[model samples]
Target: MNDITISNNPDRERFEVSVAGKVIGKAWYKAYDGDGQAERIFYHTVVNEEYAGQGLAGRLAKAALDETVAAGLGIVPVCPFIKSYITGHPEYEASTVAITPAHLQFLDKALAARA
Candidate 1:
């Protein structure tokens, strides 16, 4: 397995995963203020097609969520990929917030389609 490097690009509001100096995946998020606290809303996650099925997306998602937690920010997993990931990994649940019923519905459909 290639050594993947995950880094936060604050200017772009995204976390990126790179292998051999080439970007293979990214998780985009937006930062906002809510209830007198900082929050992060993950909206999209993408791994390069060539890098698909290599676990890059999961690595990127973990890195992004870890960063959010480190920053003391709540998370809203609007992105289906992220929602699905967090569902399987409940350890990150403490940092998650603002997940609506619609998000769960989307995740259920997405999970079913994947199955």
Candidate 2:
């Protein structure tokens, strides 16, 4: 496995992926208060074009989601890539929350644009 380093840059509201100290990918999210609990809505994930097909996005997602769980925050995966990732990884299911209609609407537009 590659020595991919994942860190939450709360100052920037994103989780960054670095290899050899070079940033190559990031998963962005917005933090909100969900009924008195901290919640994170993952809106986007992007890996450098040159790093495509190397599964760095998956690594980023796993690290981000794990950190969210560790912090006791819920996850709302509005980003298609993140939704797909969590769907296929049952172990992370416990940390996920149901998407709201508003979030769904946003996701529809966001994902459609990507398609």
lDDT for each candidate structure: 0.84, 0.87
- TM-score of every prediction relative to native: 0.82, 0.83
TM-score of 1: 0.82
lDDT of 2: 0.87
Q: Which tens-of-lDDT digit does each residue in 1-115 have in candidate 1?
A: 6578999999888899999888888898767665687778788899999989988899899889988999899988888999999999998899899766654555566557656
**41-111 per-residue lDDT for model 2 (tens digits):** 89899999999998899989999999998999999998889999999998878889888886656656755
Residue 108 in model 1: shift from native, Å? Answer: 23
Model 2 misplaced regions, further than 4 Å: 1-3, 102-115
